[model samples]
Target: MTTHYNVQKHNTIYQVKDRILIGTMPPKAQVIEEAPDYLGNILKYFSKPRTLEDSFKFITSNSSLSEIEARNLVEELIENKIISNKKFDSDNRYSRHSLYFDLIDTPINAQEILANKTVGLVGMGGIGTNIAMNLAGAGIGKLIFSDGDTIELSNLTRQFLYHEEHVNNFKVEQAAKQLALINSEIELVPILESISDVEIFDKYFNECDIIILSADSPAEIHEWINSAAMKHGFAYSNAGYIDSFGAIGPMVIPGKTACYECYKNDGDLYKFLDNGQELPSNLNESFQAPSYGPLNSMVAAVQANEVIRYLIGVERKTEGTRLLINSQNYKIYEEVFTKNENCKKCGHFTHHTENLHASFQESSLTDVYVNERENDSFNSILLDSMMDRLIKVLPNTKILDIGCATGEQAIHFAQKGATIIANDISEEMLEVVNNKVNTLELKGIKTLHGDIVNLNIEDKFNYVICNNVLDYIEDIGTRLSKFKGLLTENGTLIVTIPHPIKDGGVWKKEYYNGRWNYEDFSLQNYFAEGKITKSRENKDGETVISSIESYHRTTETYFQTFVQAGFKVVGLFEPQPPNIVAETHPILFEKCSHIPYFQTFVLKKE
Candidate 1:
């Protein structure tokens, strides 16, 4: 099989006295006579269509270059936009608007810089849509966009990307479709869902060089974004209008300039920012004010310009500077933000004790439960059976679920009129749980965003549930002791884990040496060579696949650990599969009936 690739002819070339030059309009000449001979021939092979394998073969055979050198040269040309005809960039589309950027510092290829950079545009509102256009025209390599909005009939005034036909269509999809028509060369990924959570932020923004926040979100979300930018070390800019006042502000570079909180001196905004904690979850809807299209364009264009400047490594004047514009009179002014020593986001701050724990890479526990594990009847059956037993025994009792991410048990008990307290290290999970509580209109439910192992609370609870959380903890006894202390006299603790014999530790498929060696797998812990480690795919909704580290423990250890924590196993239960499992997955139901996947226990303080 043969592959044909062509270099973009839009770039100029010059060959003079054993020297070769290639670039936009005017080629950048390199004296290759005294340099490596392959440097000159790099352009020759790229001049016509050739397979990647043959191109390497010709280069190494014709010149004194190794296989790596030839490959690197080809990659460099593509990165520099010299090889536009490569199968990768099939559009073969030449950038027509290169003069403006080319004149700035006379870069060899400004398009290459934009081609290599990725920008995440949040919100497909008037500002977000306009910025997407500017970035797409500027030849940004990729634009990752999100907007939790549908095109409204009124949006035509500012959101020029859509027409009446697009009304009620998802703003992101509509904008992406329009932008692609403008520049088919640019890679566009429409984030169908709005990014409102920290884990979601990491999933999207980890690859972006800069984040443009124009989402019609709350001030607290902006503050939360500031914290995330500081934590992730990515630059983010705030640009858009509130009513008629537009501000292109204080683009933040973590560890470099003053963050959003530094300049946003409004006391109401800083009340929660001062402590690095989020404002009340209910405040998400109270911050936005609609503005005209002109104001959104003004702010978005300015933000887009700064985003490009940041990506190209050019000195940005807008960092820590907010340019305010009043569209009524078209008057513009600048305000600067400086580093605040007490700025909670990028300043000296200490974490609360309960907040101190192994920083686990949080995935959507609830999403995972609902998507993959929920269909398994044992999961729901186990929870329902436990709740039913307790509902009869402990009416109006308070319950705690430690390491609860998007609490299933908490919501269940809360709906049953029990006061349920939930805690987890992932703040985003708690945010979702909070939203659930609000939407469900359930009462007596509270969530703590911190480590469950070091939970900070005083009220004695009638029951505590720890499900699948103990497997992650190496030092479980201490946390167990704390949970026991939180219970009233004779209070019960419900625990659930995978049955050991039923679901043995994921044993290595093919092992060597001895039978006792079955506990470890292939990827042994470096520090402890004999012991194995495990990871599971706990994340999705991103181009990059992310996984979470997990600990493997035997079911016997769970029982022994509880008994050692001064608790007696009063009752043990292995649930029968619901009828739905047999109906949907009969084979699985049969296997489960033989050795159920889950083991539940009711423990009482001795």
Candidate 2:
């Protein structure tokens, strides 16, 4: 059988000065200087599918070239992708897509590849709706999109998928109807619900090939989606507007590129936009930027183009880079981002200096931690025990509360007429503490931010309180010495840490004599003493809520380190859950009573 070849539909042959330029697109074009007259004539034969033998016969009859020379010239054209033996289905809706993809260097079954990919879209307004439309037109196999908002008259300015009749209808439902009309071959799963937690992504988008976030609500949605992308290992991108500019990407392929959190943490462009400036409270909730139709559509088109490129196995231009387009000048600026090795969301470091701060800064986890400390009987008992020693010298005493998460202990001390310096590594936690301080008008407490190891403080204090912080530090002896230096002679040091036994053990439940006991625990690496990483589970015991890293040290190591740092151990206690826990949280109380989870110590500088 004879093989047939045809010139690409988009390809063009033109003359520049005396040279003939034959190419499809800008960079893909090539020049043939002093070209033969038969070259143009031969390409005309390839305008439509024709056998190489027929083209060779034409070349031999028209010119003096032999069949072999004609064959070599045709092979060169095929190799350069100037012509191809592959026939595109002209009747297909995506036929143009196949022609455009032919210009790309990678071999792609454009329509088939896009028809197999699932895209998860979050948001159904402005940029999101446009993205959905673009993807639908490009023949994406399935779209799982979510939005709780109803269409409004204001949305009509930029959200093109809806009409006046769609006003007050749920955005997702209306979007699904409109998208189906655009392409009935694609599948649409419209969810009429607002996404607040990261866990929702696991439930809805786990099977998606890529997830795009265009929603700008709930403030922390970017962080949540980034976390989800990292966890599920899916490609992710975000497109939205920033005031007058349209922002698209930093397209993330988990482990292969910088994630959304990486941009927030270290990207220079992100920092410039953030800049620690607080917007007005009223504006924060109701501020609406002017959403022009052209700007939104332009941003959405570029974003969708990149997504389609990724699905079709072509290089995505936005990978690890964000494109910011100026609405006024129409200038597009690319901001490249690199993955942060210590980023809390996607970092691999187990002993990262900022790991603890990053863990505590997560809004959801911080909320849970704050609530647990405030209401849990076990934490209440621990706080009471620490306060017992401070009550004796509270009035007019100078104290430093290191690693003060939310300033709970510092606020308590300040209320008792003690001058307190509350210090923490997490900026978010400090913000919460500052809010409380301003609300209460507490003048005795001052908030200090930074890692304690590098924190510069000239004043010595009567007491230095380090609670639940030592477990995350690698060298307790050195940190203890620093604590000693921050204290006056004979000053007290109060420390609380996760008990070595509990921190190093793996707990399991065993049925004994037809009754289940949850206290069967064994130490996995109690004697080894190094960094330990654990997954914290939610109440359901199924979902992994978060991962935390801590250093495990033996009780003997802790005591020896204290002695070596010129401190005398005045007291040591294994704190037990308060009796009220037996009634309030019977299960927790029972398990905690049998095994100690926390250890507290009071040391005096010698």
Candidate 3:
């Protein structure tokens, strides 16, 4: 079979007498044209797909080159990734982006990674709108943005997504509409509201693969985003501009880098997390550093560059370093900042940092649950204990078990005469559940594979259960709202998150990433939220260790999301280990009773 080839759109070809310059950017070029006139002629037509036979025939008719000579030249270009069946040429939408596909040393799969991702933009202003459009132009598939303000004539200096006609239209809505027009292939969702609290702010964070923070939001709100990102283990970028000077973060990755709190707290800076109940305003405004269009554009473009590099499998160069751009002389400079050891957001927090290399989506990468979900004794300890608590509040009607790995709870519930939907992100786990459903000939149970945020279905459920998933979810508030909407009038939502108040707080050592020693221990739990460490031994008697990230919103933020979503919590259960384990491990029970391994919320839609 013959393969068609096309030149990457971004490649700018320069043909001289003895040298060939081919690159998207003029500064970088590679030699493709030597003295061979046939080679240059055949390669120049790569903007559209063509076959070797077609190239050979064209070369023979125009340049007096032999068919064999043309064949060898085309093969050489294919080997150099200059042309192939990679198909960046098909879509006229990506005609400009074709240069990026050609210039970046990363593979063609990077295109898929960027196109399939969804991002959240917290402010749809100058920087935010620019960043959003840049990403959509680069083939980002989905974006959700928020801005309460309407377009004003004053905004025209920087916010180019609007004009004199869009004055009364909401910024978010206009940005979304404009971006959609540019790339109809992209999904643009807009929120015409302000982010007043953690609950409202978190909803956007929940749905995005990575959240971007830009202009208009206060410092205090940005602090919460940093905390939420670390608590949920998602990466976020902070970008903004003022006057001819502008800056883009130090994109924060929870366990891998120091968060915003770390940067401010370095020189005994007052920690925002330590403030009392009310949100504090940043009165430290020294000057109103004025900004213009050119500055905002430069900062946003760099931030988007960092975001794209991160989406693909490229090593992140901007971590713990902010890129400062000066429009005065149009110079770019890097300011390196080291990760703080006593960082409030992630310093005392401990989790497996290896997953930072992957996308922020919760992936079921390890197959540890493959055979385990099939066992009859699967998670029996928590299953039995939580079942007793669940039966009290959860109605026996239609139920949805989200993050239900291998139908452990869903299968059990279905057997007890309750209809259930077993949803999980892992297809392998679902396959196991399906096999068990077939073998036992089970009824009243079905399987759906998807991420909880985007899984669309009719809204008629009596009960919704989300278990052990909050640590990986950036926005709990938005998810709760969706669950509330899905429920019947009196439907119940059963949410279980890792508890900071679980029993047996004793620290122990294991093979890798075990409990922290005294120095790190004293520095932990300073905030209302942080990581909780645990250990287990594998079949080979080798100890394996991991950490669970838990946000202490109940004790910290007063569970404001429930009220905002019009939910009333009827029951709250903190269950300890069964009596038998407590009797066997008396010391463990005594010390850890201060914390429960898990906490449950039984919320009824009002």
Candidate 4:
């Protein structure tokens, strides 16, 4: 028996002037124009599911084309998906969905894929109810939704899932009832409890493929949902409104795109509103933003469309971006974000450590570093402060210098009759230290090469100097504890790092009222700990540029880590370049004077 073929359902063919057109409606529509006359007859005969031999016979009888020409046209149509050999059941409820899937370029049917996915919705309010109805209409297999609020007369303005009779009933229960009427084949699980904690997500939505958060209450609910989504390793999306703007977006896939915290770290609203301080007691009262039925439905349509597109294995527009739609002017704006390597929630700390080790190992970097340390006025001022502290304990004290590049501090300590152990990650840098020790005949100076965190040394020292090293180290508390253990009972640890304000801040130019103005330097995501990458030219004026990576941490975090590690802060200093730099390098002097360039902490083991 021969197989039969038919033109796909919902396709239309017509003649425009001397040309014929075959087309279908979008979401992945196929269109063919300027067809020969014989091909039109072939399509007409194939509309009723006829075998290839019958189509060829009918085309030849109706038109002047040869049998071979008709056969080739039918074969090409099947290849292009304008016609299908697979039979579709037209009597089923999802017949139109199957026909829609026929236009897509996937190996499997999309409607079938939708039937296998389980979606969990967090709220049953205006946006949530609309999304639920849309997903149910699209034949989503199972929906697990929760809401604690009871429907009131005000809710009926935007929430379509409830009616006048459902005025006093719980939203989840009424939503499930209305959704069941739309599609009896779908599975609906409704919970009448408000989501207040992150643990509730794992309890209910553990098995869901995707969880969408539409609740706008508690203000911190998005963070809780993000934590749960990241912990469970599931895809999630956020959708809601703020004032007249409806926001949908940032469909997050675990390990693939940026999470909610990454967006929060870079979002504009977060930059101004999140200052790590509690608001006044009266200011903490709950307030609701404006909401309308049309706006809710519009946002819900896009959100639901994104979920469907993701389920069916298509490219989603909201991945790693937030889409804000303005209702007044119908303008759309987008905010794009990426996975932050320093994001406290979804960032990886090991990659930054690995990059730091690889970067300092290069000889070019060490050469430039040594040259800068010798000539940089900023370094001269930092060394002055360091020497002032070390001079009091020299001439018989044991000093352990972590990250002692080129043995600058170790050689000075050894020359003053102090025993020294210089530790560094790069062997090339340690070789330079050894070369200086051999040339100067510096006694009591030993070089140890490896990451300081992993190296084991039994000898205790009176002073441990960690110069510009904490910025590269991720686990500060653990490293501080180890440093405390490596010191004598009354030992002191000296740490120097680039000031967080100068390292993490950015200067942006704004144009307002028809003029451009340079704003004061503002710290971007100052409280969010993450890896920062900076690029600079080498001192030799070479065309090649070197990139440096370091972690940004606030002053409070460093102080807290020191206190937790049983250390007392003896001194905290923000050093400025010496006065001579103003006459020598005026540009560098201006910046160093205006901004706190380096932060030094003198901590004592208690």
Candidate 5:
């Protein structure tokens, strides 16, 4: 189809399939000289962005332009901004961007489809490779794949991206090459390392719009990602396949969703069954690993589908929690759970380190690329145990987490089988949480912009937990009362506060980051209500200074305030970081408490 256009004095007509007369561009305007001569051809092909490659192939096959000439024309037009080269920064191997089935072909809206999104895959093994392919074919704008391992011959059966020639190449890089071949429009970034590595995590976690956790990492990694995602406020998704039958889906939606910990504790009914004990059944023989095709493909497709729904804003009733696809039982199951009110990282004590690579501070790269969500390793065992205990008690319950920075607790709760609403005053924090929530393909989780003093939830929840928040507000009573309207009839409110009388008031010192240097406290001023200044005389400026200038209240004061608020204290728990004693017989400075030192008040509304 030859599309001809004549530049006139009053109107400029653009011929694309049908003549598109853009009345806005004045007729006498100078044409962008760099626009491709075959723009009509490109536009005809771009009627559907997915068929871009096929259009190019068709045009080159018939026209006098060589393949290289056709590519140059497309590039020139894109560079001139006359047309979008959706495939500009990509490499296509299997299909072109203009070739995917439109939303009309499925029960989806094409307009709702996100053609410009970047998603990160943490591993490029059987599962990660499959996930990358599915997302790429779906028209996601950019694909980032991470894997430290090199492609091995054994990985050939399931990891299709690696050919015999790619035997020793980094799995992620090889996968990127293959993925690019499939859809050049999809930008591929290869990270050759584990997601848990500080360098890799910091580089990709916040940059990518979404992340999929598919590596067989340690249990700590699951919590780390949960906390990091919540802290960074990114959307994260995790899917697992076992015995070719059991599948688990956990998604964290920032502040307004259940988190990974929530699902780990609540959704997996058979979770922690042995509790470090011997295996109960001889299913070890029957539980042999299953075939990779069905498990990998089905799970990856589900993950991709969920990503699409999140991008389109097609709200789901089940926003946060775990979906159990049990082909073994021939029954699909789902569970709603709540947050561990005492979660160290997501709870009152501020488990978030804010600086992970402390030891590496001397390294110039450390300052440039270190994870901010580093937590103190001293309390890992206690916090881990406490999280288990808390989840075991609540099992699964609807929860509202107040002052939820980055919705990490919400993500944990959602993962544990709870419906969660993660709320915070900072929009930046909420944004990060929402990104991870969308990535996870979770249900029953939501994020809201709100202050603890004025919560705006219409529905009441079985539990409302506020961690490390009460101490920051001056009007504790008034701020807490707002929760009354949001709690269920018999709901419990779990509050964590630093015991006012503990260890000679508040201690302030510049501790080393998990790496070697100090923290970047610059962006915090906009979020926190107080300013942290360096006092030359005082040293370290009293870290944890009250956000609102208020007198610290002792345990008695807290109890009195609750009575007036019409809440009865059911449980008073304290958390103590390892090696730091709550007190050494009240007078000495050596002994930490055997019990958790920070107080967790579990209260019930009258």
Candidate 6:
């Protein structure tokens, strides 16, 4: 009697006898029994990659063999040297070779099997090399690996495939060699450079089926990856480790899920950045603990696991999501985030405007001092510097402050001669602002309870101020795009996010918060138009990690989204911490100025 195994839509089905097996077949791995050496031939099959144990698992699953018979068959394959016996364990449990191949057990038709697949890797370290080996071993006909550096002896800590003999070899090249040796049937290509270069990015992006970002280049590189992945509609995976913890997942299905950019700029980055600590440099070098090797392998293994599932027709139920790992204590945490409608990379911003401009609303005397002295100092400095800049340029302007938390900025601008409209999704926040307005007898300031995405005011404003709010927003691009709609023909939008690039305390701030608090997002009094909270941890203490409506944008990505949404560049300025306290480089952008920090951009809708 044959038993039917439940399988995904496109998986292949195999009926050996009393048992059933389902999975995708490598492109050229047809079931031809007459050729002889079934086990050996199976090991050699590769249009993609496959391991010896994978074959055993498939054969046993599909055969009518009971446990005893399956064990005997496995033993036979091992004795015949068709498959090797090795113990693979991570976080304590021994992992069988078959465990690594489970992601591909799905039925797929010939047409689906033949489709070309392209993959990208940002880092070429242990996790990266391992992932490559797994895919190449599986028969992914063509392969590409990118890394600017050559192999070094220090890499031996966990980068298993490279050795002292391979020192000075390009990492990608060495990785290619090891992969070729593992399975000569697979083709491999190595890109010996960084992904930071735009030219390099464009070259490899168009041809990729899925981009696996395992490299730890920088926060900015992630934006480029997100931009390419979203613009091309290809799947992208962000996989890496910080300390003992790591994460691996995709960014293909948009809107329905959070893209990588969101993960980087949203609370996660903030938490990671603020964690106030860095992994010991030597841990990844050749000097640290045995844990490095196994840990890196586990990360790579998980990444390959996800990739095989995607390729062999496993519906990635967790696509566009995050899988967080804590190797320190051995805990795996999964966080599901939503794609921001205002995402700077793929959000709704390219539909309007062309010119870029910059301006700020005026505030009244009392409005500037609403927060008690302690809280007001930091905000006051930012406001004073910003307003001073605007006053020198567009003196008499209309301004809107999104997430006007307590309407402090609005009050400040009102005193400075600009008509200010402050908006916040929180009624309590608005009430506080109104109460302060009453206390200060501040006029020329209008308070509105609204969301940045749906601020339906009739008239356009000359300037928009989004301070510290961008990081918490769901879609930075969508919010920026809406800012475009709120702008006059030459209006400007000024947004300030946590200084993700700043050093010292800035970096320390991320770690202080753990993950970030998202519990309050459901409370209407906190944010009226809040999105759902999937997972949130107390992030680094620098910023409040709210699971409400927030998104972060890299300096470049933010500018690009602005330009795409019909805004022209002007001047960019980064804020410097008072000369005394060390601060991350500030980037400022005016409509057209291009400096790195104080990233102040001036824009006008054309």
Error of 1 at 145 (Å): 0.7
Evaluation by TM-score, superior candidate among 3 and 6: 3
Against the correct fold, how does model 3 do in TM-score?
Answer: 0.49
**What lDDT tens digits, residue by residue, belong to model 4 across residues 1-606?**
778889877678765655656674554454455666566666777778888788888878888778898777778888877788877787988887776666565446788889999999999999999999999999999999999999999999899989999999999998989999999999999988899888789899988889888986666788888888888887999889878888887788878888876666454364345563432334645755778999999899999999999888888888776777777866666666677687788876222211101133334667755766556545654565555655455557999999988777788878878899999998989998999999999889999998777888999999999988999877788888889999999888888888998888854533221122234667777888888886443322221235678899899988888899999999888887778876665545655677787888898987
For residues 484-588, could you state the per-residue lDDT of candidate 6 as single tens digits? 888888777776654333210111111111232122111122222324332211111112222233333455666677788877777665654353221221111
The clash count of every prediction, one per candidate, is 1, 0, 13, 1, 85, 118
All candidates: TM-score: 0.40, 0.55, 0.49, 0.56, 0.38, 0.40
Task: Please give the RMSD to the true structure for each candidate, in Å.
Answer: 25.4, 25.6, 24.8, 20.6, 25.2, 24.3
- The Cα error of candidate 5 at residue 51, in Å, is 26
Off by over 4 Å in 2: 15-18, 266-286, 349-606
- Residue 597 lDDT, candidate 5, scale 0-100: 32
Instruction: Summarize candidate 1's per-residue lDDT along 1-606 as a digit string, tens digits.
Output: 666766654546666666666553434422334535556566766777777888889888888778998888777766766565433333535334454454355365666877999888888888888999898888899899987778889889988889999999999888888999998988999988877677667887778888888874544668677777877788888777645778786688887777876656532244446555544565566754677877778888878888888887877767776666668876555555667777777885322111111134454455665444434434554456665765433466888888676666688778778888888777777887888889998878888877765656989988888877766666879888988898989788888765544434433421111111123323222223112343333212111114444455565677888899999998887777667765565444544565556778789999
lDDT of 2 by residue, 1-606 (tens): 777889877778776565778873567877888988777777777888988888778878888788898788888888877788888788989888777777665566678888999999999889999999999998999999999999999999999999999899999999999999999999999988999899889999988999889987787788788888888888989898877888888798987877765666443232344553433245365666678898899889989999988887888878887777878877665666767677777775322112101232333656655656555535565566656655455456899999888777788889888899999988888898999999999999999999888988998999899988999887777788789899988688989888888888876853222123465778787898888886553221222345688898899999988998998898888877778877666556666788897888899987
- Alpha-carbon local distance difference test for all models: 0.69, 0.79, 0.67, 0.78, 0.58, 0.58
**Strongest candidate by lDDT:** 2
Off by over 4 Å in 6: 1-105, 108-115, 250-256, 269-291, 348-606
Q: Model 5 residue 418 lDDT?
A: 88
How does model 5 score by TM-score?
0.38
Query: Which segments of model 3 are wrong by more than 4 Å?
Result: 6-15, 24-28, 32-50, 53-74, 88-91, 265-289, 315-317, 348-606
lDDT: worst 10-residue window of model 4: 349-358
* Candidate 3 lDDT by residue in tens digits, 1-606: 778778755566777886777774434467754656655666677767787677778767777656786677667787876776765535566655655655766765677788888788888888998898899888887887887888888889988888889998889878877998878888888888777777765666675667888854554677778767866667888888644668787688777776776554321122344642343565767746586888888888888988888877577667766555667865555544456565555776432221112112322323445533333121444445675457643345788889887677887778877788998888877888899899879888999899867888885788898877765565677888788888889778887765544312434322111211111112234344434444432222223324434444443332566667788888776666666644544333433343455667788877
Candidates 3 and 4 compared by TM-score, better number: 4
